[model samples]
Target: MTLKKLASRAITEIGAVLDSALPHQVEVMAAPILNAKRIALYGVGREGLMMKSLAMRLFHLGLDAHVVGDMTTPPLGTGDMLIVSAGPGEFSTVSGLIDVAKTAGAATMCVTATPDGTVPQSVTHVVHLEAQTMANDQEGATSVLPMGSLFEAVQFLFFEMVILHLRDQMGLSANAMRANHTNLE
Candidate 1:
């Protein structure tokens, strides 16, 4: 296949996944975030990179968002939230951190492909994003992208949409979000 063809296929696949998301799902993911006093996000591997991207955007929207394991991340407690990605549905580290956050009186939200997975089952809320992940990316996989790329790619777009929803919901202007961007960059 040509490079352009591959890119188009990938883009179309991502669009399908995003289209599958219900409006309620986006609201489910955003409501707790808006209610939280502090937000900590986590994921493993490439999914972690996506979570970090979301944290950055949330920060730019004037929210107190932090990535887990960051040096400056504050402790999560009452009125706080932990947003985690378990694309394949269960990561040991993700589960462990969720436990800790819940024990500390923080709400937890999980983004997952398998809503039935143990991690998702345990979380306070879940946003199900149906896409091919490492969990189901073996023989006969549906996505052209390898391993969890489909899930991760869909995550990037999904998170961006969530950010837009949040910005609008919070009555924030694009300029307002821009103002919160780091000057050091």
Candidate 2:
């Protein structure tokens, strides 16, 4: 019963958090998606998977979207955009990537739980969400849920909302995205 209550509270609280911030996040993501010259994405670990999913939807919307570290991650020399998800916003490798992208003059956006972290200063856009979920297997200072599971789940949920917004704005058909889904699957 103790375990059940903890799980229930975590889910409800995480849901409440997303319900509050999602509208603003989608609104922030839209302008860059609509106007970007190039849209490259980066995220670490499970967050990377979430960002990859968002990038795929952007591709379905006909934007020039690609994941970072892929063969197709072309130079974002100017006016191009990089969207990264960093929950704590202080992951070492992600910080380094932010540094490189900033030096190259790429516009960057970070969706993070910590607004005060290093990436915000280096990037062009910021979307801050207050999540009580930890990342990885450790209990982060900010996570109420163990090991960031709630954080990972919320990230996935947020991307789906972003896809919904993109579909409406870009006029993408379900058939079109379906066509792009890997045939190997």
Most accurate candidate by TM-score: 1
The window of 10 residues in a row where model 1 has the poorest summed lDDT is 16-25
Cα lDDT tens digits, model 1, 63-91, are 99999998999999999999999988789
Clashes of each: 0, 3
Model 1 alpha-carbon drift over 4 Å, by segment = none
Instruction: Report how far off residue 54 is in candidate 2 (Å).
Output: 1.7
Stretch of 10 with least lDDT, candidate 2: 133-142
Query: What TM-score, to 2 decimals, does candidate 2 have?
Result: 0.85
Choose the strongest candidate by lDDT: 1
lDDT of 1 at 120: 99
Q: What would the per-residue lDDT of candidate 2 be over residues 21-52, giving only the tens digit for each residue?
A: 87998788777777788988999888889889
